[model samples]
Target chain A: MTSETTPKSLRTIPREKAFYFFTSIGNYTGLSASSLKDFLEKINQVNIKSLEFHLNRGDFEKWLNEVLEDKKLAEQLGRLQRSNLSGDILRSQLYEIVSRHYKELTTRAAFSM
Target chain B: MKLKNNTIALDATDYKILEALREDARQTYTDIGEQLGIAHSTVYDRIKRMEQYGIIKQYTTIVDAEKAGAKKITAIMTIYTEPKESEKVAEKLCKAPEILEVYTSLSEELQIIAKITAENQESLHTFIANSIAPLPGVLRIRTSILTKKFKENAFSIVSDPKKITFIKETRNIERRETV
Candidate 1:
């Protein structure tokens, strides 16, 4: 979900706490996202290599859980981790989870207002 | 690690880290990463996943019981039980703290093999006579005291950690339809 539905304390993180993408060990793609919205965009732009690297290392879930304080996304990704999905299948599923969450948050924000 | 057909695939890095840790568990993440040429954070992450899967079961220090003045005697017990009661007997043995390990051999006759730990000879005999003999379907019993020491190799003992490629094992549970 986006920050709109997320608690203010966990809505958006500072630069130092942002999620960083890596192509592999010691291989940074120079891509980082400081918010869920930014993350959704960056996920599309970033290489599958970077996604695989971060997914294998569970970096995405760690960022979601530790920085964004979003357990829902973290848990959704955790289940995906077990699903043995990869490549575009993985990327699309990854995008779908976040996009669905982003939409969910946006809708909640709209209704709450 | 790569994903192939919805499974999380493990790479050499995970094994190398395990090999390093198996050689020495106290090695810091930084040390392993430096030797393996991966990011230290990656090393940490891999090990944590291994732990979650129970792949890395435990890190323990082997203690010399005799040198430490502990009256520990190891006994190898072979129990011949009725075929129908073999598993039951083995499971019962597992409940005893004194029973270190329980194994079943499917021979012509079902045999329960157990590694038993005891304080002294008298207790060992007492346990076998009292607890073991009284168990149902026990046809006979055999015991051998390990009188000497030998190699106990913790390393080099077991699987190749998924033939050098690890995969998280998941089982599908389905309900059977019964009339």
Candidate 2:
């Protein structure tokens, strides 16, 4: 099978199990993503406040580890969180890490299928 | 009194004062005190202390560079520098007017990310080839020219000070002997 058409088990979660973005404890940012690819995209448009909020709350790591089952990416993000980065720097760096991981994971999943 | 690390402790009142300043810096101390239910003199004293300690660096307007008739090409220049020379490269880059923002990202080694602005594509190319590449410890650079910006600095985000860790101010502190 082509990498794009690789088996479902080799892929990230579907739309049903998407992670949501939030600005505060109960304030949702009206954004959600199912797969790593989708999360990678939505993160850019989401407010830095949401990114700061989620990073501090361990929400992204939790969702990545639990819903996406990608502990490596989660841990990588965890390291960034501890670095005391905030604002657009956080967004850009977070994007760089997530995109790199997404590429590696997708390639690995394709081969493992 | 300054702490051992050249840092200052930010209490709830400090956070509230910061929040008020963030909302409208031009507002009078009396106005802030009225809103926060503190005396204007208290607000004045707190603000003065904050400024002296180097927390409130400067009160400046956040200009929309693009809208201000700046026909400059912006590039997200990500450069990987030798671990030991990271601080030197970053300090030099910080002094460059074209390089607006400089940040160190978490990677295998520290990576320098700079938001740069140039007059045109030719200038942008020249800048990378001439200015960036010659940096002694620079390993490689990846420049992503931003075609459009959906968002820039979101100043409206009122950060919670409780979660925010206060740290050392880079400015030289006038250390006074605490009695």
DockQ of each: 0.00, 0.01
Candidate 2 Cα deviation (angstroms), residue B118 = 1.0
The DockQ of predicted model 1 stands at: 0.00
* Clash totals in order: 3, 0
Clashing pairs in 1: A84-B6, A84-B7, A85-B6
Cα error, candidate 1, residue A93 (Å): 84
Best-fitting candidate, measured by TM-score? 2
In terms of docking quality, model 2 is incorrect
Off by over 4 Å in 2: A1-113, B1-7, B154-179
How far off is residue A63 in model 1, in Å?
69
Candidate 2 at residue B178, lDDT? Answer: 30
Q: Estimate each model's TM-score.
A: 0.50, 0.51
Candidate 1 residue-wise lDDT at B21: 89
